[model samples]
Target chain A: MKAIHHIEKQTGKAFKLKKGAFLTVIDPMGQQVSDMVLFNSHDVNEKLSSGKSLDFEESILLTKGHFLWSNRSNKMVKIIEDTNGRNDFLLAPCSKETFEIMYNYKGYHPSCLENLYTNLKPFGLSMDDIPTAFNIFMNVQFDQKGKLSVLPPTSKGGDYIKFEAQMDLLVALTACSAEDSNGGRFKPIHYIIEE
Target chain B: MKAIHHIEKQTGKAFKLKKGAFLTVIDPMGQQVSDMVLFNSHDVNEKLSSGKSLDFEESILLTKGHFLWSNRSNKMVKIIEDTNGRNDFLLAPCSKETFEIMYNYKGYHPSCLENLYTNLKPFGLSMDDIPTAFNIFMNVQFDQKGKLSVLPPTSKGGDYIKFEAQMDLLVALTACSAEDSNGGRFKPIHYIIEE
Candidate 1:
């Protein structure tokens, strides 16, 4: 087991996960959300695909035993364990525009998209390269009419989900910046990569 | 009215539309789908955004009177008329991987992603630049549990959706190739850009 890494509120981290290694994302403060994106370290173009994962999984509620698939139709990671099962793949990462348009705030705001691109820039990723993220611990519900609503996470402190990487992967993770996503208060998120 | 431009079955086209021009996407034959992507002509970085459109519109089913929004929180186009009210923005443009993974086909296959990148190349758009398209006449249904299913388009011949460009735009259109999306057959799509 490796030491836990902490991602401060409204911030992000980018790292590489070896094939077969376990990566566990922990909502240490509960009610907070984390956004995570993955790419094949070997070929960045073969990145995580929300549409493919949702299509192949056959359910929007992806949990334990379901695989996260890539744009190239390859499995990237498998969820081995889930303490809090609700996550969202339906929405893109929040950005500055999200706050202005949705929240009606006009000033500088930290956003998951900004956090992600800033941290991933070292890996040669750009704003346009970011995709719809796999939002861990974020609860998004949809009605029969397909209207979506973001709700506070149902996780308690120390809740986590564990995944086993299927290939060498570049992963970006963020402590979500949207107030609506984190019950109106941002909190730090923690992760551990087990060798 | 300008002459109708035909996009061959399982193929695509790309062009530019001046601001205030009307672009009507027509399902010339029944039960076909067209995937459309829009980019700001002056700044490709500010392109159509599915999440922002869904968030701002507050509905997954966008029709007449709903505006397609950009990543930068600007309205890119306004849907002024819709004869076939159903459309989908929840899914990405189908790619070769879609056939291999979902349909279990091995050989080469036509795909919206390929058509988009091919036609959009002259506009300086690459494969990675393609975003989740606004799927005209594509009927995608979701269950109460959030599971999604692609159903046959409900459009009849001559059904069309008209959009007034809110900005000078670079547009890509694809006559979709996925069998499930078009109810087991492919058909050409038609468009007219009127000043």
Candidate 2:
């Protein structure tokens, strides 16, 4: 294989992205993903139900290149690989206090933010620079009573998410450090950010 | 204030735990937790660097919680809870890939086999019945190495961690989220986890 270092300039030695792009969703390699839910952080207003024609917004939100987990299994998973364009992304870690309010507060952990900072140093990112994102596989939804209900994630093991970029963007990812009891399971979600 | 419905147990609030007496670290209200390590799971050979300090193991892991975002910010952040114990606890989350490699790709996510699993679900322990842990916010000197290194974390954006149990625990904390940023800048260094 010919090794190509860095693309100093925009060289047209590549492929073109169509107006519409495609993505693939699957479970992480060697994981048994269970119940989980994922929503687009950029656009919470968009809706896309399974077994239906996904809209443009759904396409972006459910696009591959992102992943989710739940119940030690990944029911709905996606991993996006945007060749046409780029996608903006963010990475957020989980913690405890939210645990008690969310559940019986069974599982407890150290600061995931602390982990993100330590690992990001290898890549050169920082806490302040990190953007906000949805808690993948975390099934949180609003009800008719305007109450937020918790749903098990829709992702299963080995599930992945893929999508084409709508535009040029920066994506950040981390192998979350949530406790195993809640079922995020500390399983490393497969993350591949490629051109 | 209106009184909420309270149920009186005929047995006088008797509870049953695996152990007659359960031990864990604690952090009370308005307390300043200090330097300590949190593992993703219970530690077997975890050695301390000082006098015989009392320690406890979390019955489960920690995925998400509420915690103040400042070590010295003096600002009380919510959701400042994770894990059952305060210090000397692990069981934080890692990436899905890290999950596979660390465990030789044998177990699944949030499976509690890998650290990732424990991070997602703490007490529901699975796979190995307990996963290895990432020492978050703790200074350790491995037996093989004489130098002590800080075990940071991965998290950001008003992130907080807390722990809740029949009992409470105190723990020192630090916000980690810069992989390769300047001295953990994406998020500045703040030691929260206070009361």
DockQ of each: 0.52, 0.02
**What's the C-alpha lDDT at position B49 in model 2?**
12
TM-score of chain A in every predicted structure: 0.99, 0.44
lDDT by residue (tens digit), candidate 2, B8-37 = 110001111121122122222112222222
- Candidate 1 has a DockQ of 0.52
Q: Provide the clashing-pair count of each candidate structure.
A: 0, 177
Mind giving the per-residue lDDT tens digits that candidate 1 earns over A1-195?
479999999999999999999999999989999999999998888788776787788777888999998876789999999999999887889999888878889899999999999999999988977888899999988887767788899999999999999999999999999999999999999999996
lDDT of 1: 0.91
Q: Compared with the true structure, what per-residue lDDT tens digits does model 2 show for residues A14-99?
A: 12223223323233532212112122223221211121111112121333343322212222233444221212111123334434
Candidate 2 stretches with Cα past 4 Å from truth are A1-26, A29-92, A96-112, A122-124, A166-170, A180-184, B1-195
* Winning candidate number (DockQ): 1
lDDT of each: 0.91, 0.27
Off by over 4 Å in 1: none
Best by TM-score: 1
What clash pairs does model 1 have? none
Q: A96, model 2: CA deviation in Å?
A: 5.7
Reported per model, the fraction of native interface contacts reproduced equals 0.47, 0.00
